[model samples]
Target: MLLTIEDLTKTFPGTVALDGVCFDLRAGEVHALLGENGAGKSTLVKCLTGVHARDSGTIWLEGKEISPASTLEAQEAGIGTVYQEVNLLPNLTVAENLTFGRQPTRFGMVSGRKMRAEAEAMLAGYGLDHVNVTRELGTYSVAVQQIVAIARAVALSGKVLILDEPTASLDARETETLFQVVRGLRERGLGIVFISHFLDQVFEISDRLTVLRNGRHITTADTAGMDRLELIHHMLGHELEEAEGRRRHRQGGVERLQVRGLARRGKIEPFDLTVREGEVIGLAGLLGSGRTETADVLFGRTPPDRGDATDADGPIDLRTPRTAIAAGFGYAPEDRKTDGVIADLSVRENIALALQARRGWTKPIPRAEQRRLANDYIRRLDIRTPGAEKAVGDLSGGNQQKVVLARWLAMNPRFLILDEPTRGIDVGAHAEILKLIGELTAQGMSILLISSEFDELIAASDRVIVVRDRRHVSELVGEEIETGRIIDAIAAHENGEGAMTP
Candidate 1:
């Protein structure tokens, strides 16, 4: 093994991010670190990269016990990390970004000519020789920027390279390009740690798999023999039997919202959808499969170029989020941190946000009413907080998610859009969110659910719509909504014969 972590542990004030987690990486191989959010993947990565100090653990790099107190120290000790968002300066030229800190110097001045040559040679080893080293990095595509980031990391740390969600923003062709580079790096005897939510990508590139759940190491095994369903069970820590029991059988009422030819160019293809009263319509797909895009269009975050939608109030033009809200629609975005919650505000303030917005700024929701709403939701959703005045940022990931849901629910919208609502939360919180979904649906609240977890969708959805390459390819209703069928639909090709190569 080129790198090994034994009994690694780290903790915060109220949470143990990692507990006795062990991992190893062999040279010339790709090791995939798999886990859901709050599964200790990030914590482990941070500890390894010297971002966080481990409470207690032993890290061996090439048979030498090492303790790196900073990222620079880790890099110097032969470890490098390239994040999803490239850390390189976008305004600088590619060569400058690569050789920013360690630029070649001559006669007490930076040597631009030598720096550019070094960058060119570095990129050439990764088959990125075509990229002009002198061009501004921001001008190029995200895939190229990623390659540049990888090149820099490799130059700094020759042994271990950690790629965190490297292909999240990349397209199909771009992903293939990045994979070719990664394969070459592996062939060169570099130990690459691959972290991503895309299972297809994992199975394609990984030599070994390590799963973590709730900050504990579950298992480490070869990727070749591992079944997809089995891997999911490890990450989620539950059997298919329990997930099956979550399958709901609610009878939908009259059509609440009907959409026809809704689309945004380059985002999602024109699609038709119908969400009825008291129904949970699930959008299932791989990451970047237009699941979030569909939600955005439905919520009027990105208004459709050409589409017709009608509700009980007749034809409704969803030009913006405000219009959507007026139409009795509420959306809980996939990323709660940036888009959903105002972490700086109190729990009470956060819960009352949507209602206050709908009521207009001039007409404030009275303090008493705000208190009542917050108290009601805190008790109803079981949000673990000392008081409504507490800052939402101080809460756990699961509680923060509940606060976002509470904010939207206070508006009592007829339609709700939940995108990855149970993600990153603990098992207990995950079940609570699912139960809440069922209860909300029972009360005639139409929901458009988007989840990467197929079992969750299978359990909660009355109907499942499969999205592929930003297009709605198939829809499964009634008994058709099962794990096998959903996976088949996702892996199936355009002609419906076999799996998609990507």
Candidate 2:
């Protein structure tokens, strides 16, 4: 083994991020670390790369125990990491970014010529000879920047290269280009750790797999014999049971929203959808599959270039967020921190935002009415707040999410769009959010629920639309929706077979 870990563990306030996690990698093999968000994959990686100190565990490289004290120390120990977003300085030239701190010096003067020469030679080895070393890195396409990042990392003393979501933003050709570079590294006997949410890519590139769930290692298996269904089951930790008492909320009704040719430039391809009242239509796919993009268009967060939406009333143009709000649409975006709440304000103030917007600023919502609205929803949603007067920023993640929901609920929306409502929240909070979905839909609210977790979508949705490459490819409904089929559908898309269901 080139690298081995035994009983690695890490903890943070109110949660254990990693519990007795163990994994290993061999020279010349691509080892994949697989998990959903908050599954301790990041924590374990951080521990190995010295971004966080582990509470307990042992790491061995070449049969010798070694603890990397920092990122610099990790690099010196022959482990180098490249993140999802290329972290190289965009302001600098490709050569400058590549040789940032290690510029050759002659008489204590920096040597630009030496740096560019070294960078050009390194890039040529990775089939990136077309990239001008003297040009600013930001001027290159994302794919070119990614190759530059990999070249720089491998040029350093990197015995083990960690590529985290390296091909996330690349197109098909770009991804193939990256794979060629990776294969070459593998041939050079360098251990590689690849972390990504794409199942097909993992099976295509990895030699072995390690699964993590709820901050603990579930299982590890060689890729040759393992099937995709088994792998998804290991990651999700669930089996499909009869949808009996659990599915009481699906009230059949007429369509409440009809969107035709809705799309934004370079965000999502044009798509059509019909969502009826009391229906939970789940948008299912991996990350960057246009789930959030679809929701953004529906809610007017990202205005559509060419599209028309209609309720039973008439043709409606969602040109902006306020238009969406006025038309009885509610959207709780995926990211709650940057887009959702006014952290500095009181809970009462945050919850009252939407309704006040509807009422207009001149006719400010009465202070007493705002307090009543806040208290009612705080109890209705069971938001854990010190008081309605407490700053929303001071609350836990789950509570902060509730406050965002309350803001929309206050407006009495006819259509609601929720993107990843259960992500990054505690387990207890997850259950509560799921239950609330059932209650809201049972009471005749229409919803478009988007999530990456297949089980959550299967358990709560009336229809699950499988999206791939920013387009809706297939769908599954009651009695037909299972984990295996969903995995197959996703795989089918990758292999160019996913299409409209018969």
Against the true structure, candidate 2 reaches a TM-score of 0.64
Off by over 4 Å in 2: 104-114, 129-136, 139-142, 167-174, 240-317, 330-502
Weakest lDDT window of 10 consecutive positions for candidate 1? 493-502
lDDT of 2 by residue, 1-502 (tens): 9999999999875568789999999999999988754577767878998999999999998788889988778887888888767889988999888887654453146577877777787777688878889999999987889988888888775688998778755645677788889999999999999987667778889999999887899999998789877887787676322234345335357888888888888888888888888889888876677888888888888899987899899987798889988888889886685788989999999999988988898899999999999999888766766579988876644577788988987887888888887654433345556777777877878888988777788888888888877877787877667788877776673556644421
Q: Report clash pairs, candidate 2.
A: none
For 122-204, candidate 1 gives per-residue lDDT tens digits of: 88867776789999999998789999999999999989999987875665578888999999999999999998767788999
Clashes of each: 0, 0
RMSD of each: 6.0, 7.4
C-alpha lDDT (0 to 100) for residue 389 of candidate 2 = 92
